[model samples]
Target: MKKLIPISIAILFIAVIILFVMQCNVSKECAAPAGKAETPAIRADGTDLTIAYINTDTLLLNYQLSRDLNEELLKKQEDARTNLNQEARAFESEMQEFQRKLENNGFLSRDRAEREQQRLINREQELKDLNAKLSNELMVRQQEISSQLLDSITIYLKEMNLDKDYDLILSTTVGGTILHAKDGLNITGEVLDALNNRYKKKK
Candidate 1:
């Protein structure tokens, strides 16, 4: 009776193995034929749909309006600089004449020379302060304009998001940092197109 029981257990084990092999074969048949399985687009985590990259080219294209804005701002700055330079030169010339008058015949009176020196020093300080104030004010104005333009860019980004259904948007231009990518991962062109559309609408 013991021998029969052992033989029965061995037969059951063999039957189980055979059934498992048959089921595996059936699964194989249900799936793709050998070596023809469809590859999954994503991993088990369910990512890797579509991603894009943009670079300096994308930014320049998307925000070309900034170029014109900068040009205008620079023109104003240059004009201001030119006018300030003219004023500085005039002040310097007047100081030179005053010094010449104070040191008549190459011999300056001690009291008169000292007074002229103090006036020149005060004028120099005034000129320095004016230059500093103008430079700071211009810098502030530039920053304000830049902030405004960036707000416009954000508005355009929102508009483009509504227009296109992109899984990921990226940049690779000189200023944009992109560490990795594959083929068709660049959406710089798409963003540029959207910016162009926005420009057109503004017109």
Candidate 2:
């Protein structure tokens, strides 16, 4: 089975960016003269209230860091599955041997047979415990990678806006609140290029 990172984390990342922009919007609003009327679609700087949005889905699909992290996570998952399968196969082979011994009356007495049965039971429990542990470890590792990606994206946005002076930046996802937007307002391609470039530099 293919495991995936939780969608809520991605949503939360977008929410944080939106919240920051909202705060900036409020600041802009408050900065105006108290008695002054609000304008429809322009800022005080004579700019068109520079706004752009990122398509989160496209961003994740194209972002180098996200791609790398996903590949790493997938490798870890495959490794865990392979290790577990090996252990399970070994356990199954032992169980088969035990069953053959019982069929041939290889045990010296009932007590010996009972002890063998108990050992098999204990081994099964051990396998179950190991499987759970591996799953949990993978989940934790995935979450850590997700957090790192989110941090990287957030930092990049801050740096990009340092000179761009965007009045507002938004994130949009498929089936999200953003129902319609102009093609010119989509900046996913630009963000993806920047992310890949940054990742290449770090690499």
Query: TM-score winner among the candidates?
Result: 2
The lDDT for every candidate, in the order shown, is: 0.52, 0.73
Candidate 2 lDDT, tens digit per residue, 1-203? 22333332232343333323522353465133344465534554444567778878778877777877777777777788888888889999999999999999999999999999999999999888888888887778767876786788878888888877677778877877678989988888988899899899989
Candidate 1 similarity to native, TM-score: 0.63
Model 1: per-residue lDDT, tens digit, 6-118? 11111111111100111112222323334533422322233333344555344553455655566666766676677678768888797878768765744357786677778
Could you give the C-alpha RMSD of every candidate to the true structure, in order shown? 26.6, 4.7
> Residue 13's C-alpha lDDT in candidate 2?
44
Candidate 2's C-alpha runs over 4 A off are: 1-49
Cα lDDT for residue 13, candidate 1: 17
Worst 10 residues of 1 by lDDT: 1-10
Please give each candidate's TM-score. Answer: 0.63, 0.79
Measured with C-alpha atoms, the lDDT of residue 149 in candidate 2 is 69
Q: Among these predicted structures, which one has the highest lDDT?
A: 2
